[model samples]
Target: MSLFKLDNVIQNYAWGSKDSINQLFGIVNPNHEPQAEIWMGAHPNGCSKLGTTGEPLSEVIDQNKLDVLGGYTAARFGGLPFLFKVLAAETPLSIQVHPNKRKSELGFERENAEGTPLNASNRNYKDPNHKPELVYALTFYKAMNGFRPIEHIVALFEEANITTLNIELNVLKAIGDSDALKAFFSAIMSLEGERKEAALAELYAAHARPAKTVMGREALQYSKEFKQHYNDDIGLFAPLMLNTVELAPGEAMFLHAETPHAYVQGTGLEIMANSDNVLRAGLTPKYIDVPELIDNTIFEPIKPEDIRLNPVLKEGKMSYPIPVDDFGFDILSATDESKAQYLRSAEILFCVEGVATISSEGQSITLKPGESVFVSNNSSVYQYQGNGVLARAYN
Candidate 1:
């Protein structure tokens, strides 16, 4: 098979940006609702379609898994292992983490046995696969990822004069990183009613004061934003406990399983394992599974530099290296003076900027900004040439 155009699925979540995805895709928003994500994959929940035909891409792949997903991938993952998405976040997302494969399988089975509906809003696990993701910033992106160093978090609490949390802070200081994190997190998530509100009010007032450090300032800003959206929810205090990271366009970060994270704002290209399972802790109206989140979360401190995936630049492509065998991600840029590079895989390409013509042996397709195409492995080798940036996802 040659290259097939894809009709992507757009998800309009409440926290999505109003203009980013629409502007990128050149679509006029009639309702002006938030356009959160454009999903391009075979996931049953939000599968992409073959352009014009309206046939689900998942069905097409299942009919010819060997040709579309390749033999090894089809045998191992049973389908496409990765789900590609364009995420535009105007408001902060929930504080959430994903389980590992084993935990996911177990949780999924348990939920199934309990007769929990698959579409239940309170469902914790949606699939029995681990979701490891990477986000490539399309604009200035801000997120809170992983845990901050214990000493730094302690100092932040001290500086902010959060006396109500003194007991939890003391416990954190007394124990090791993991136990301290669990204890501190448990204490925060356990706060109820008036006590939670009172604590949040105090934290909010403290955050209003000018912060001395960069992280502190960012945390305060995030806290204010979270408060505006969620009122006095305890999740507003997450910024103070997690590492705040800001990524410029082209920079990327990898999120492994059990690493708690929340995307604060901005648009990005995200790719993850083909799973919808999300273990949310707070910062949203969704179900909060405190024990599950705490049990699965990795409690180690993560530096911004440590989580960053520096791209390896080739002639015309920049590959973001990850440890997972499920998928690979790359940014392919072509110019008038560029050479046509060969690609060998069942690949999906989305043009984020400029116009580009991608050609296989005797077939070719032109992709404009926000347009995407699926290239089957059956196409021996294809090359693209134009002046634009394209994101490629493949196994």
Candidate 2:
């Protein structure tokens, strides 16, 4: 099979942040502090073209008869199974939940029957597909990734002296308690003016005070920002509020469908199953589907640390600390010319610094800083010679 090189496109998404003064250093950064997207795969919403000539990747592969990228992806994933994006959160994203396969299928049909456009911002069922996502930190990335276990949040609420949120606390006490959390979310999301405003005032005050736990500190920090973006969004009081994660450079996290989450701040490399079905609940002016988010989301409290991936190892020739089936990322830093371990799958190498040459099957490509290349599966035994850092990804 011929190697199908990737055409990396630098896209500026709107969700990016201005306060992130550090993540923008040295890259071809957006002056408007726009969210940056480095789309490496093909998903029609945005697919990287072959070159500046504007030929779509789907068309290129269709004409070439190349076995490097499967035809299924060319049809379904729009030419690539993975879509890599660099998400830099300028402001808080909406509190949202994705629909699982069954739910998405049903919802898509229901919405279609109701005559909702596929492109409408409020349309939660864009497709009947489940999106499982993974984020690798380019810098320190912070987010609320999942449902926090109720007890932890209850404890946090107590430590912060915000006793008024007890309506949710009592709900969790019931047996088969999922509905209680759902009810709490509905109450908050559906609530209006004065009553909700008073509740937010108390919650905001508690989040301001210092508490002993890590969750406590995170709660206070994020609550201030959440309030800044959404003054009285009742969803701010959900149990998911208690869990906030911050990932350092080189770390990663995975989020499956129906995992209610919000990207809080910082820059990172994100890849997901190719779909965009987000049902939002706050912090932004984007569409909010209160009923959908309430029904689809899970309300348990989560510890920020649980989503973090521990470094596996850095031994021998490769540092293969990060792992995923869709793609595996390896950090390579060579002090001298060295050969990468041979593998069965197709791979791509991105040079981080200095100069490096990848050669296999008598074909070679020279890579410099910010340059990457797709390696044929038949060209697995390549020698990389230089002094620099690199990331190698393959299926």
Candidate 3:
């Protein structure tokens, strides 16, 4: 493989902050401060900065200027379907969902039939693909994953004395499974006037003090945002009302298609299968296609507390987890006494910490903090030498 540097994009979302400095050591400190996303993938939206010839990434990749990645990624993903990013969410992200490819094609076509612009805000379909994401937390990450079990939600609604939400909850209880949950979500999204207003009132009445102090405050903040957008969204009460999961550094959660989810807060390195089709189910100001979301959602009640991971090893210079083809990343830590291990894969390794040197065959490169390198599948066995942390990505 030739020597070509990745072009990284820096994004400053609301939920971002720095610990000691900004983008120096990848040491992200969150206090509701500005954060940055270092994108090193081939998505048109944002691409990493190239090392040579100060130019946008797309130009280099387009002209086959980067001899290393020219033919590699394109052949694998059939045109880089995945967008690699590191998000520092100091504030809770708007609750949203992605549609599967099937749903996207159908929805895009349906809209075309109705004369909506292909890039219209109301256009929910971006492409024909399902996005399954796996986010491994580098720092402590908190997010709401999956739906709250219908029965559990029903019980919670009753406990809070939420008459309006409870009425819908009861209806959901009668239906029992995820499909019923989908129906319930649809009803909430579509109902207007008196019924919607009544539902909102009940949700507000049922709002509970979040046991997690920080998140509780955030829930209140989003509740206000929800009111501003939907006016009477009963789902506003949903955040404080559902289960929340806090992942310690190194843990991860996988969300398959139609699994209702939301990232409440925290910062982390996120990876997903190559796709961007989302079908939101509220918690956002984005387009909410209630009927379409209902049709595509799998909806069985899922709780955030249930997220888990299977840790493989952590004693040596590195740790490797069970690999699933979409993408795999492992945390690499080194000590003075640690010995470098050989690595060779159709992958990209990123150094997020102390200095380290990666050598393969007879070629080698030293990666400073926040720098990364791409290793071709044809590359020889490689080794890491230094004291630091590294994350490797591959399909």
Candidate 4:
């Protein structure tokens, strides 16, 4: 009654890898379809099914809210507050930002008042909940997070010498702060006609040559790589303006609300608030509301170390100091000395390496790499009794 096995959904999106998930999780892919993400929570869009009875996780939760989620969490969130996913990106995702709680509520309400259908391509807000994510790399993961320092951004643009962007570039150089970044970025993303062409053309030509600075070389390679998929989309220049970092296996990063970011490549375990709202900037065919994205984005520069997390290790567990209340993550090393966790909120345990058997009261479930189990708060306590690495997701 406390432990439930989940039959998760695999999202097949174009940016996914056809082989990575299969290779890492033993998930068979005979059709060779792109396996983008694995949905492992009670989200209505892709609710996981109970392995034993095939009932949707949402229904199960709705029917037994307090029993499943515990008194405090049920009272606070009304249901599950987070969604868990295994995301594998073979290419760049859309350049995008998530709004904060207040912005998300306003946008969702505004769209509803206008009668914008939720599924409409132009609809921006999906729910009134903000999505703040923490990703732990399963492989070498590459991403662009936050903005580059204004001076560095100016230097790159100055070096690229895009004649069309001269005015905006000069404006940014003159102001040289967050406000200037906002104005400059907004203008650049909103570029039209002859000016857009001239700027993009100059950027390609400049990067197409041998590199000048180390940062320039990175910009050159990423721009070329992005072009392979998006083909000169304005977002392709993201590397030139944003801070880029590669997270090694077992490394982690946090993407907070209003932060501009994009996943460039590789696989990771991502946990976020149970929301789908997204405001796109570039890198896809998706509708981009540039003004909304700009409004929601934080135009501040951050070093790779700022987003790349360093966890606190204690008692065979690693915990991230997340700022949000919607979700919490911990990695438990289960060996002969495994400690039992007293469940105060609902939890999901996913085995990532080796094999482990989780036991509660008198029941047990064996999990292999990629296998996950949903644990109800009614269980109160549970422990793992094997040698393996397990990622724990909770409220």
Best by TM-score: 4
Candidate 2 matches the true fold with a TM-score of 0.82
Model 1 RMSD in Å is 1.6
Q: How high is the CA lDDT of each candidate model? A: 0.86, 0.64, 0.62, 0.90
Residue by residue across 1-395, what tens digits does model 2's lDDT show? 33344567666667665534233334555465564566665567677565435666656545642344544333443334555665667677776688787898899889999999998877889987666677777778878788667666556666666545566656654532556656655666776777667777777777766657776766776777777667766656643343588888778787767778778777776766557788886766778877787777766655656677664565533443433345566667655746665754545566655777776666566666656666544444666667776666655
Top model number, lDDT: 4
Q: What is candidate 1's TM-score against the reference? A: 0.96
Worst 10 residues of 3 by lDDT: 64-73
Please give the distance, in angstroms, between residue 337's alpha carbon in candidate 4 and its true position after superposition.
2.7
Please provide, for model 1 over 271-325, each residue's C-alpha lDDT reduced to its tens digit, 9 standing for 90 to 100. 9998888998778888888888888888888876687787899887899989898
Structure candidate 2, residue pairs in collision: 16-90, 17-90, 147-300, 148-300, 148-301, 148-302, 149-301, 149-302
Q: Which stretches of candidate 3 lie over 4 Å from their true place?
A: 1-3, 15-33, 55-76, 105-115, 208-234, 240-242, 303-306, 314-324, 335-346
The CA lDDT at 29 in model 3 is: 52
lDDT of 3 by residue, 1-395 (tens): 43345657666664455442254555445653565566766666676555666565555445552243434445654543355667666555656666765776677677778887767888777666667777777677777776666666666556545566566677777877766666666766776788777766665654544423454555455565456545555457655444567788778777667766777555566777656567776656667777767777776655545566664665553343533345666676655553444433345667777877777767677787767776644543566778887776665
Q: Using TM-score as the measure, what is the rank order of every candidate, best first?
A: 4, 1, 2, 3
Candidate 1, backbone clash total = 0
Candidate 2, residue 381: CA error in Å?
A: 5.7
Q: What is the lDDT of residue 302 in candidate 3?
A: 58
TM-score, candidate 4, is 0.98
> How far is 156's C-alpha from truth in model 4 (Å)?
1.4
Instruction: Residues 198-279, candidate 4: write the lDDT tens digits.
Output: 8889988986788889888887788889988888698977888988888999999899899888999999999999888999
How far in Å is the alpha carbon of 1 misplaced in model 3? Answer: 4.5
